[model samples]
Target: MADRRLAIEAWESLFRAQHEVFEVLSNDFVGTDLSQAEYDVLLTVTRSPAMTARLRDVTANMLISQPSVSRLVDRMVGRGLVTKCNDPDDGRGALVTATDLGVRAFRAIGAAHGKRIAEQMSRLDDDELLALRALTEKLRAGVDVDEA
Candidate 1:
């Protein structure tokens, strides 16, 4: 019982910390060309091979619902930040590729955002940051099994 209670408390702390950090980081996007959601999508898209990713891959990386991601992608397409095309390898799947405009925008925002993230995280010492990263990855791996 004590163990379970401790686990619950730890989880709550983790959740609150994530929320707080998210709120702080979200401020960085206020006047930018991308919303947090759009930046998230672009981040994943940009990280993928050749700066293109499958729609399902993007949805998987995002915290938003599949429908929400679809809608967001449509909005981004309309803005000319990304282009969607039928995946040649998978007839049922769509591929999202960052346009030159999207790449430029992402690069501009990413530089500042990266610095902001580093600054925010600087509160943690290097050792603590390494431990936190390992712990979070472990937690994610546990959850990912269920997700898969």
Candidate 2:
């Protein structure tokens, strides 16, 4: 019982720390005006090979609803950050691809975010950080994440 209590406390502490950090980062990114959802889509599209993805792919990758993804994509397209094309593989499917502007934005945001996260992680010793990674990976592996 004590062990379980300790574990739960550790988890809550981790979540609280993460939330605080994200809040700071989000504030720093306010003028850029990228919502968390838009950033997630940008990350997904930018990381994918050729910076291209189908609408369905975004829904699957982001674990978001199709309509939500569509609305986000539509906004992104209007901003000239992304473009929608007819999917070659599926005539009826719409393919989304990041534009040069999108890549530039992603690069800038990713650099700042990476630097902050790296600096925060540097507070931990190498061994402690590695142990945390191992434990988290083990916990994640135990979960049954549904793929769409």
Candidate 3:
């Protein structure tokens, strides 16, 4: 086992780095039609097949509570960004589909947000970035994540 002290220090470093980068990258959302949280939801939705995703899948990717996610989806529905309907596969679950406007906005924000992320991550070379991703993935590998 690694030294407990070193383990704690490494965890702290990873946490702080993620928080700091999140703070810095959040500036990319300013003056945008979508907030950071909304962008996250759309990110998951847009990446899914047919620009649609299960609400639970979105909820899984979000840090917020399920109820909060539902509320956000409702707001997005009001904005004509997405539509919600009962999942055919799961009667108790719902599916969220991105509207054309939602896809447009997501793509618009995504282009710049992606560039900003790349710029922030540029501090590390490609190899370092790959290693970082590997380490993170390894860390998360203990948990089971569903691919949808």
Q: Which stretches of model 1 miss by more than 4 angstroms?
A: 144-148
Q: What is the TM-score of candidate 3?
A: 0.93
Candidate that would win on lDDT: 3
Worst 10 residues of 2 by lDDT: 27-36
lDDT for model 3: 0.95
Give per-residue CA lDDT, model 3, range 25-140, as digits (tens): 99999999999999999999999999999999999899998999999999999999999999999999999999999999999999999999999999999999999999999988
Q: How high is the lDDT of residue 139 in model 1?
A: 81
| Model 1 worst lDDT window (10 residues) | 139-148
Per-residue lDDT of candidate 2, residues 18-130 (tens digit):
78877876764677746667777888888788999778878776757889899989999999889998898999899889999888887777888778777778879999999
* Candidate 1: tens digits of C-alpha lDDT, residues 105-135: 8998898899989998999999999999999
Return the lDDT, model 3, position 1: 88
Candidate 3: 10-residue stretch with minimal lDDT: 139-148
TM-score of each: 0.93, 0.76, 0.93
